[model samples]
Target: MSIKTQKIFEAEFLLEDMREIIRKTSPHSAFSKDDKIQFNEKLKKLSEIVEELRTNKYTELKIKYITNGIELRTREEDFINIHPIQAAGRLTLEARKALISYGDGYSTCDWCRKPFRLDKIHRPPIDEFHSELAEFVGMDQARVVPGARRGFQAVVSSLIEKGDSVLLSAISHYTEFLAVEDSGGTVKEIPLNEKNIVTADATVQKIEDVKKNTKKLPKLIMLDHFDYMFGNEHDVYGIAKVANEYDIPFLYNGAYTVGIMPVDGKKIGADFVVGSGHKSMASVAPSGVLATTDEWASKVFRTTQMVGDITGRKFGIKEVEMLGCTLMGGTLISMMASFPKVVERTKHWDDEVKKSNQFLDEFLAVEGSKVISEYPRKHTLTKVNTTESFDKIAKTHKRRGFFLSDELRKRGIVGEFAGSTRTWKLNTYGRTWDQIKYLGHAFIDIAEKYDVPVKANKQGQYSGDV
Candidate 1:
């Protein structure tokens, strides 16, 4: 068959179109001759990479590890893997194809030719998509951001000032601390209860403590729906209510909740809601959505009316925090393509939770293993302490902690942090019942092989050995 008849012909056409657009839009006077030549060389390299992807030239680089999709690496598996991080945002086949098709240039912006305004008349669908996204999270307005951290940054920069105090969970993600610090605000952590869960009472106490210590009410209260370290669910509803009582603006960090579970920002009493597209929205990396209620929309999404000081050029656009246009190209397109599936999957979040609990039960059945997260997990990400069971083997084993990793790998298991025999986390978010059962059995079998006593929990029956 001729080259035109090949599957890559469409990719070739798209690349050529992109090249033509770049050439036509290029302001030759803005760049020196050498700079233009270098730019052209980079474009050529990009074109070659696209061609290689179109022809499936990278198949040889595939890894065979069965991690259940925990880490952010692609695999050639036919079925879904039982990974915590990978399960929620795992790209659909359709999303992958969409990424390739729209990967050539800033396709969305290039086609729409609009900046700052998400709801432009020329880009009706983009505007509609923004509306749908806002509605999805039960917020009044929303904008695509580079990531969830950027969402936090935008809100903090707009609302916080130097020496302003912000409230966060004791187990809040590092990004939250960085966002507040970058905005010149001080962070006060709400201590966790013995259950490893952040309670509303603790939040209230922390808020009052901050007021007393700093002699000022906290400017913002940010809490995660589900913490990353332990995957434990926090009492965001209660915390939000507390924020309202104090008249403090609340920002809901839904990095682990938004796309994977049902979240209503207004119902939760949040002024702002942040979601990670790459973490839970089934999109590529560095993509996220920042949403806000109407009460805070004017401040967070304020438009720019600045004029160039030197040339007196008026640039009417959106806020500088958003940096004008946000996500474009493959990231936005893939998110759009995966929206329907994500919507449907979130409706069945109960099933995912049930599976997670079941897997945890079997893992706990092995004597000396205990789950560190709250019992009857509300989220799929879990922290466990297996020092009694697994670490016991690591004490004298020749390979030490690595032996467990080697054994798990032999059983077609991956995603667990290597050399971690004592305390570690795993996500059983999207595993099939069979896979979950097998995973549970794999741990028990490995323990038994190591001569660790295995006593299955049987109703009221007590094993004094354990």
Candidate 2:
């Protein structure tokens, strides 16, 4: 059977069984001892669903619901629901197992033993994994954090003081702003060019401007490899060079690049590197890695050496900023399980970009569709303006923006933001060639049905004339 067919079949088959299980597991349900035993037996019979969950057989599941007197079923694909294409870094099979096995409290602690350090030398596996993580990002030391934002918090808290200036891209993620603000530091945004790319020259100018205005150099420079809004790749290498010349510490925000693309912290001249496990490292939510060079590791990961003056007690084991250990449960294990696959996939990043651009070309084949992001797309996630074609229908149709979403849904496509017709974003990450082709065709078919003017390119790919 085809991929879509298989998924639909699986979803239909599991629906009733899962519903029954959920009913039995509901907290409101009152079960006698015998009833509990019966439910346990029933759960054992649902070995398939359990196995699927354990193995990460599918990244998403479709559910049927009766709404407004109409029966409807829809697929819930991650990341794509809000954007066009999914990013390459979703959870892996091993990650799913790790989540289940280590999700219980103290599981990680049990394995690592005394001190409970994620990178302690006594625990060879955890220590080795820590070493591997550092090596993966070309840094001297690494630590798993609650998320990328925590990594930012750690670095900012370590470096920034009240009234200090920090340089950031105008399009930087909100978490960066929060991190800086929490550190009592002032932010200076590096303006983007017409292309929305943060150029090295612009960063240098901003640094000089900040120094002139504040009478002091900014304490840190943080920039994203690919901004979330546009998924546009910036000149990080160039920016890093500028930071080096100014003797400013640079933090490379690799939340979108670390697991999906190759990055070298040293090569980029980054004093610190931060990455998101859920967004790009094939792990569950709220997990990330913070890596730094040897020069800064002592400061960023400094151990707690404070003593309780009255009690005469000392706590010297935990890192000050980390607050003991971060990513203690399934999150860390899932990241560990996904590390090898993440490493392997980064090698084929070029092919992934090629596929992204190919799909974009076909998508733009529809008349009046224009890509809002940079051309010759370097990233899979793209912002698009569909004002000319889809928006025309949205203007007249009673359903408005929802007409396009309904059409795509019927064609087994999901992920486009609901009620959005003029401008929207989508990610085409981790999709197979066949799926990509079908997606392009789905859009073209919808436009043709609505009488939208669509002309095929010379290559005849997605020529709405079909």
Prediction RMSDs, each to the true structure: 8.5, 6.1
lDDT tens digits, residue span 362-410, model 1: 7887789998888888989988999999998899999999998888877
Q: Best candidate, lDDT-wise?
A: 2
> By TM-score, who's the top model here?
2
TM-scores, in order shown?
0.81, 0.85
lDDT of 1 at 347: 98
Worst 10 residues of 2 by lDDT: 73-82
Give each model's clash number.
2, 9
- Candidate 1 weakest lDDT stretch, 10 residues: 1-10
In candidate 2, position 172 carries an lDDT of 96
